[model samples]
Target: MGAGRPLEVDLRRVWDAILYINKTGCQWAYLPHDFPPRTTVNYHYIKWMTTGFFARVNAEVRRRVRKKTVETRNRVRGSSTVKASRAPQNLPKNPALTVIKRSRAESIIL
Candidate 1:
């Protein structure tokens, strides 16, 4: 939810953090400090659990393994909300142009 501070956690690290939490049955707050903050991992996990994402991932992996086939499609994907940036970086600075510009202009007009 980006409630306090937006997190930029790696996907692999987040999964490892989740596995640590689940396998250990530790309280979310008590997650090892070396992993991404517990709340961040929990936030993502709850979101995925709610959206049936884990089911899809499991099914895909199982199918690939059973078939002994290389993945033709991506193995997993987060929800649209999860993929959304903390801030909309591509918003148009000059709406009339229908063009997005960085805070600092690409070039100055004479």
Candidate 2:
């Protein structure tokens, strides 16, 4: 019913949520049950996207696989990773909660 467990999240899951959100175009609260909470996932999404962390990762991976320099480059920085324990199951997974959470997260994006 309310936001629960303000904690860090797994980067892997965060990345997956970002991909899922982009691919599915679904609201964050609509994510599948296997995923971490919408808040956790979205929080990391905002953090990484703002820091340009994913851009660096893609460039590095592409360079490794293609054996060529990437046309687009970004500055690399030490991004601190956070590992949160499992999310509290008490809160119901619903769009209303994410709507509130996303309101703040959206400010960062814009």
Per-model TM against the reference? 0.52, 0.49
lDDT of each: 0.75, 0.74
* lDDT for predicted candidate 2 compared with the true structure: 0.74
Give the residue spans of candidate 2 off by over 4 A.
1-8, 68-110
Instruction: Give the C-alpha lDDT of model 1.
Output: 0.75
Tens digit per residue, CA lDDT, model 1, 49-72: 999988999999898796664442
TM-score of 2: 0.49
Please, what are the lDDT tens digits per residue for candidate 2 over residues 54-94?
Answer: 89999998878665333222211212212223445487789
Q: Taking the candidates one at a time, how many backbone clashes does each contain? A: 0, 0
